[model samples]
Structure formats: C-alpha cells, structure tokens
Target: MNQLSIFLAAGGGKGGEMQLLMMGAIILVFWLFMIRPQAKKAKQQKQFINDMKKGDRVVTIAGIHGTINKINDDGTLELQTSPGSYLKIERSAISLEWSQQINKAAATTVTPTK
Candidate 1:
C-alpha cells in the first residue's frame, strides 16, 4: 500500500492536464453533435421564412395549412386556408420541414399535359 500511494502521487502532476484535455474533447464533441446542427437548422429556418412570397403553400407549426395571400411588413403572413377563409399568423409560425414535404409532394403529383 505504501508503494502504491507513492506511485500514484508521482504521476499526479500530469493528471490535471489530462483532465483538461478530456474536458476540451467532451466540449468539442457536444458542440458538434448538439449545438452545430441546431444553429444550422435555425439558419435554414430563417432563410425559409425570408423567402416566403404570395401564393406559396405552407404548413404552420400549429398544423394549419394554407397558402400565403399577403406578406405583411410586420413579420406576419396572411394565410388563406380556403377560397375565402384567411388567417393572420407570424412568419416564424411556419414549419420548414412540413412545408417542404407538402410542396415536394405537390410537385411530384402534377401530371403534365401533352
């Protein structure tokens, strides 16, 4: 036991530096797996919202489906749910994934006339 304690004490000087290196690695892994993807997604969402225009079909985070009738200057959208039914919602309420899925499906289902 005396020899084991002396061995451990002699090697203790490098342990703090190893711990700091491990901590840095953990932080790098966490940022790559968690923070980086979230920030990229937020940037994509912002771009999607900015690209909105009249007549673009979209789905809201609340699951409301509509076509944009008007782009308001105050960060809001005038959504037309039906021929005459309209709802005013914030631009950020649009779901990028849902809207893209819906639009992609619509594009593929269109039958071209000869």
Candidate 2:
C-alpha cells in the first residue's frame, strides 16, 4: 500500500544484494564519521594525560582548577588548589582540552608589554 510495499514488490531478484550493499555502506559511513573520530580523540586524550607533569595548570571534568603538585606512582595526582592546599585526584579526571583552553586564554589576556 505504501512506498515501502511498492519498493519491496518491485525488488525481487536484486533486492538482497542491494540491501547488503546499502547496509555495508551505512556501516562504513557510520564508522568514518563517528567511531573513528571518537577513537582518535580518545587516543589523543590518553597521550595528553600521560604527558602531564608537575607544576602544570589543569582543570578537571568536574570544573576544578589546580596546579599539579606531584605525580603519584599509583595513577593519581596531587593537585594544589592554593598554596599549601592540596587535593589528590585520579589522573584520568583531568580534562586536557579545557585546561589548555583556559591556560591559553589566561596567557593571551595578560599584556606582556605593559
């Protein structure tokens, strides 16, 4: 009765191959647009986390901002919120992009020539 019914009626011998090709195409496009980029971003994030060092300013996904005071051997970080005030947090909680953006913005906002 509908367009789908009409299409199904018309598609007899070649319909199975067409459906398989279309499904394969859909999967390819989905991986190209979605899965691949997400995996790449995850790899970059892991690299960023591994590269972090003491005295580096960073922000967490929870919106906490601090400076790295110490790198623990147990996959955790000691963050200094202020002088003599420290908080221990997991390394994975750090947000690489937010920290970089904030630090860059802070750097740009200050007029060095002044």
The most accurate candidate by lDDT is 1
lDDT of 2 by residue, 20-114 (tens): 99999999999999999999999999999999999899999999999999999999999999899999999999998899998999899989684
Global lDDT scores for all candidate models? 0.97, 0.94
lDDT of 1 by residue, 18-95 (tens): 999999999999999999999999999999999999999999999999999999999998999999999999999999
Candidate 2's error at 86, in angstroms? Answer: 0.2
**TM-score of each prediction:** 0.92, 0.86
Question: Distance from true position, residue 36, model 1, in Å?
Answer: 0.4
Q: What is the RMSD, in Å, between candidate 2 and the native fold over all Cα? A: 4.3
Model 1 TM-score, 2 decimals: 0.92
